[model samples]
Target chain A: MQQRGRGRIAYPYIIWMAIFIVVPLILILFYSFTEGDIHNLKDLKFSVSSYKKVLEPIYLKVIGNSFVLAGISTLICLIIGYPVAMIIANTDVKHRNLLLMLFLVPIWMNFLLRTYAWMSLLSPNGLINRLLLWLGLPKIEIMPGKTAVLLGMVYNFLPFMVLPIYTVLSKIDKHVIEAANDLGGNSVITFIRVILPLSVPGIVSGITMVFLPAVSTFVISGLLGGGKTPLIGDLIEQQFLSSRDWHFGSSLSIILMIMILISMAVMSRIDKSPPEEERRKI
Target chain B: MSKNLIELKNLTKRYNDMTAVDSINLTIKENEFVTLLGPSGCGKTTTLRMIGGFEDPDEGEIFFEGKLLNDVPAYKRNINTVFQRYALFTHMNVYENVAFGLRVKKVSNDEIDRRVKRMLKMVDLAGFEKRNVDSLSGGQQQRVAIARALVNEPKVLLLDEPLGALDLKLRKEMQIELLDMQRSVGITFIYVTHDQEEALTMSDTVVVMNKGVIQQIGTPEDIYNEPINRFVADFIGESNIIEGVMLEDYKVSFDGLVLDCVDKGFALNEPVDIVIRPEDIRIVVNPDEGMIKGTVTSVVFKGVHYEMIIESDKREYLVQRTVMFPEGSVVGMNVQPADIQVMKRGDVPCSKEEEEG
Candidate 1:
């Protein structure tokens, strides 16, 4: 009886999604073909010239750099986040809930605001540099560079990596771990062979998160990386803001969107693979 | 050579306030299968985990073949465990899961393959090497867990209720399978469970425990026939413990009846509990001939036999016999001198320690 109205209940959400997401995306696709600015373009002419402009080396270089930055940040996040998550998940029962909340709390902050906050703490006159100068340390020009961008990428994505990995680690039965030790697989061996492999789903989820956001984000690069080091997001934003070429920006956005879709498709393929089961026969 | 394969000397584990295992001193022999029998939270699993080096006893030293195991980590220990939840590798296929320990030890690929296959076949799971373990049945997963542990061929096999996850029929089947495997391998098995029947049926030695203390450790028959205290007699099987007074060295007065028991060194007029297994008491059809007269209050029809509860002097005593008695059969219950075993009241570690200074 309760299941009878399920489709009707979901009808409103579907209509709202079509109006907000699907229609806007279709408009973006259609706008990529429009020619010239509105004042000069009394009659709109549809053409593929905007797409040709997106294929230029300047735009492609930033896309490539975005991939490299996202890749590096993902690697660093996994290395740092996995162990922290593991310690939290497997440690004393009394403190686990608190640890989980602490890790999760940072995500509630606004993404753009957090990136700017890092800028204040990383600049030459920022607290971090001021501390180094006070300590009689060499002046470090660390802020407003590729390093800052990478750091921001990792910072924003660390929780995404940690939460999934922590969940998987917590679900791991300690009994299986004991069994591994009993079978002569010590700490290192057990972690590498059993724990690591079983946690691929979480790792993959983490990687996707850090990689996708880092690759597409302009806000961090603009605030911390400075305008000199262009990324795909910054390059796309420039076409609309400074260059005033809406069609070209739309084409670049389409390319970035396609890349995201491709990666998502690959992740879905992996996610559909076999579930874990340890077969015991008697 | 030291006959004992593993020994726990005054082992105790305390967690801030609660002591999980308290001074448990046990010895297991080479090639002998033993079961630590107790209810949940009774430190049986803690005891097994300590033996496997997964847990460290707070106040004891462990010895394996005369080698001290104190401070030894789990991996360095030469033991394998079949975990209660199977604990089979979730990510790896059955073959890889079984082959994992060998790979870690850098065994030759050919040899690892041979050993994994042999162990898998031994568990009756041939042709399942490539199949993902998650795709298998519960019993199949359990077999993989066993194969994974057994393939390593460690000195001792620690199983913490390995068969507890299975259905009743599967559990029974696995019991036979486990016994067969144990016989063939000749490896010492330290099985932990709360099941009395499983322990009685499979273990060469059974250790009964309750509330962080070992009650008795002996062969199945020894534990069954000569339970050291009231808990053991009650735990292993149903026992009618009657409150009595020790009239002499081996004589006790139980309610309006006096019976000769085989116990010594009790003070005169000392309060005691005489424990008698239901099967030990015999039922006679003639009400006048037996030592104690009673009427059948209820007759239970157990398959292949009948168990009757006898009521005499407002007290109930169970008497199990092959012959079925009618619902209202007026019968007599008697016991031979050899069958009536007696122990001091509240002698067991668990039940009688309610109020202590």
Candidate 2:
């Protein structure tokens, strides 16, 4: 009886999603295929000029730079976050909550403020460089470049990577690990064979979380990279706001959306098929 | 070679102030199916974990095949466990889970395949090599767990209530199958369970434990027919424990009535506890034909027999009889001499001491 009424309760959420998610996506698609100001679509003419403009060498380089930096930051988050998640998940119950809170506390701060903080720290004469100089180390230039942007991206997205992996790791049945040991598997072998494979869902979600925002981040690049490294997000923003070219900006958004979707599909497919096939194999 | 395959000497484990397994000394012979039977918090699983090297005792030494194994890790020790929940790798298929031990040993793939298939076949899961472990039923998962443990050919196999998840019918079937598997594998099986019937049905020796101490260790018949104290008698099966006194050699008295019994170790006129199995008491229609007379207060149909609570003048006796005696019916109950077991009152290490002292 309760189940019959449950469907009605979800109607509000369905309507909200249609208005917020599906309608906006359809609008973007419609704008990407037409030429004119998006708000004045009454005289809009359908064309491929925006898509043609997206493949230009300059915009293509910006997209490539976006991919490279985002990929690097995501990889770094995974490397740093997996062990952090593992340690937090494996900690005793009393300390686990505190450790997780510590990892997530930075996320509560404003995203732009966090990036600006990194900008100050990565400046040429900042605290980190001063510390390096005091230690008789060579001072290095970091800010106003890809390194600074990467640092900001990694710092901002790390908690996203850690939380999901932690959830998966902690939910693992401890007896399964003991069973592995009983089967004569050492710690390393048990982790590789049991723990790691079981944690794939978390890892995949963590990757998506870190990668998606990192790919389209305009603020981090603007604040830290000082416009020296313009990502696709910056290009799209320039077209929409500065250059007043909604068609080009909408096309970039469409491409970014497609890329995110394709990657997610590829990742989830990678996550699902191998485990299924391995289990199905005799 | 040592006669015992595994020996635990003065093993004790404590969690905070509460003792989990206190000074347990047990020796397991090779190829013996021994069960650690007890109540839920009775240290049976703790003792099994100690043997499996999952938990090290706070005080004591463990020996495996006469070699000191106190510091041996679980993976290093030749011991495998079938956990209560089966603990089969959900990410792996039946074949992979079964072949896990061999693959860890770095055995040849061909040999691993052959042995995994053989083990699966032995467990009656011949065609389930490709099935995911979570897709299998409770009984099938249990079989997979057993197969995974046995395929390693460990010297000892520890089972921590592996059949507890299954239904009664499946539990019974698995109990017999486990016994058969133990016989065929010829490895020491140290099974843990709270169910007395499962322990009795499968184990060659049953170690009855309670509140961190072994109450008694004996064969099923010895445990049932000659339980050392009230705890073992009550834990193993239903029994009518009446306070009694040993009158002399081969005689005891309960409820102001003298009765002939086989036990004779107690001093003359000394306090004792008498245990008579419910099935041992014969319910008769004539009051003059039996030793004690009572009116049936309640009768529960227990499939094979009727469990009737018969109230005599001093105490109530649970009598199991195939002959149905209606409630409120006056009936006579008879106890044969050999069926009555007498033991010292302060024998169990449980609450019996607090109660009787």
Candidate 3:
């Protein structure tokens, strides 16, 4: 009886979830399976055309581009972020919090403002090119291209990768590392055999955190890509607002959700597998 | 056993302003099971870590088999440690955890498997090779830690209170098992623990430490029967310590009674501390026929004996025997001449301060 009363506190949250989350998802599902005026229930008839339209070659390319870009950005984040996390975790307690706070200070500002700042710095005749000219170097084109979008994704998502990995690295028992040293492992071997494998869960979560956001980010691609490198997110946005095609947009959203779910399932499987299996894979 | 395997000369380690291990000298022989026994913060673990190459001493030298090892890192040293918490790698299986040392040296897989299996069998963890380390019980994890350290077959093994986390019965069982393992392996074992009983049960030489200094180092029997100072006598077991004056060789006076004792080499009429073991004192049936007379204050039943507190004219005495003396009963206590141990008073000021603190 006590547990039941305590659980009653969650009723408001459950109602909130049903109204804000479940209802929208159900409407999207209904839109994805039927083609009609969504505002008029009389004309809303069951159909498979919206789902069939998602199989077109043009849409598939956009989805592939989204995966490829997100995958590359996540890989870069791991490569650069792992060492940064290790360095942060190994720092003395007096300075570790300061270093972590410095890393997170930029994130406290508005996301769009940070991206806009990057845009100003990377634009032609902007801060970077002006500095390059002042150094007597040739002018380079980075903004209004795929390179700028990739840079934006990496810059925005890098902290997501570092924080989880740092958390895991710091929580690892110092005795375990000492034991590795006692068992005749040098620093490099100890890191490879003990620390790296132990931080796999963090790496997995970091990948998910970076990849999910990067894939569906329409703002960065739109601002930096100059409407040239259209990703799945941009296509879905255009379908809803510009073309006024909610059915197709709803279908694309469902497909993207399914792809994310699949990737998450695969990531969790990797996380659950033993370190020996991971070593064998390497 | 005759050959000195490790020698520490004036080894000292200080952390900031506090000296954790003071300048001390010690020699550990080959095939000896030596235990560094002390209470927490006594620097026993610091000394062990210095020997293991985990911590470099701030002053002095550490020599292993006649070679200077002060600059050697822990991984480069030919020594392995079974950590106090059993520090088993949770991400690995039992087999992988035990085989880690061999794998680091790039040993052949067949050789690693054979040695790991044999070590597991010795620790009675056979058929547990594929099990995850986190799935094992605390005692089982301890055995794995032992097996992991022993698999390398190093010249010496450092165990920092390996059985400290186990239950009482399991700890007792592992103490015997560890003794057997040490004999079979025939390697010098340097163990550290705060548990005096464990140190006594398993070590050939017990080093008693207090306040970053060696209080005494001797066989368990010697340490128990002939502790060198007031600190050693008081720390080792239950004892009645009383201030007394040495009248001459073989004679001491305390509680208004002069008695014969075996200790000498002190200045005549010098004030000294006298230690009398509880069990060494005999309660006489007739109060008038004893050297010291007292009234029993309290009696407690301890599994194998009865402990009674007797209040004499000078102080209360804790006496242990097979017989129970009821409260308020008048009793007389008699002690053998050899049982009265005389020690120089206030040998170390830190321990005195510790007592007061």
RMSD of each: 3.8, 3.1, 2.4
Error of 3 at A105 (Å): 1.2
Estimate TM-scores for all models.
0.93, 0.94, 0.96
Q: Global lDDT for candidate 1?
A: 0.84
Q: What residue runs in model 3 are displaced by over 4 Å at the alpha carbon?
A: A277-282, B347-357
Give, for candidate 2 chain A, the lowest lDDT window spanning 10 residues: A273-282
The regions of model 2 sitting more than 4 angstroms off are A1-7, A36-43, A276-282, B326-329, B347-357
Cα-lDDT of candidate 3: 0.91
Residue A72 displacement in candidate 1 (angstroms) = 2.4
Candidate 1 CAPRI category:
medium
Query: Candidate 2 falls in which docking quality class?
Result: medium
lDDT of 2 by residue, A1-282 (tens): 899799899999999999999999888898889996556658899999999999999899999999999999999999999999999999999999998888788989999888878877879998889999999999879789888888889999999999999999999999999999888889999999999999999999999999999999899999899999999999889988899898899999999989989988999896886574374473
TM-scores of chain B alone in all candidate structures, in the order given: 0.95, 0.95, 0.97
Over B1-357, each residue of candidate 1 has an lDDT whose tens digit, in order, gives: 428889899999987799999999999999999999987778999898888887778998899989899888888888888888787777778888888789888999889879988998899999998887789999999999888888888889988898887898999999999999998998999998888889999999999988889988999999998877788877777788877898898788887787887777999989877878888888788989888888788988888668888888758998787887786777787887778777767746444221111
The clash number for model 3 is 0
What DockQ, on C-alphas, does every prediction get? Answer: 0.53, 0.65, 0.57
**How do the residues A38-113 of candidate 1 rate in per-residue lDDT, one tens digit apiece?**
4566666888998888778877787888888888988999999999989998878899999888888878999888
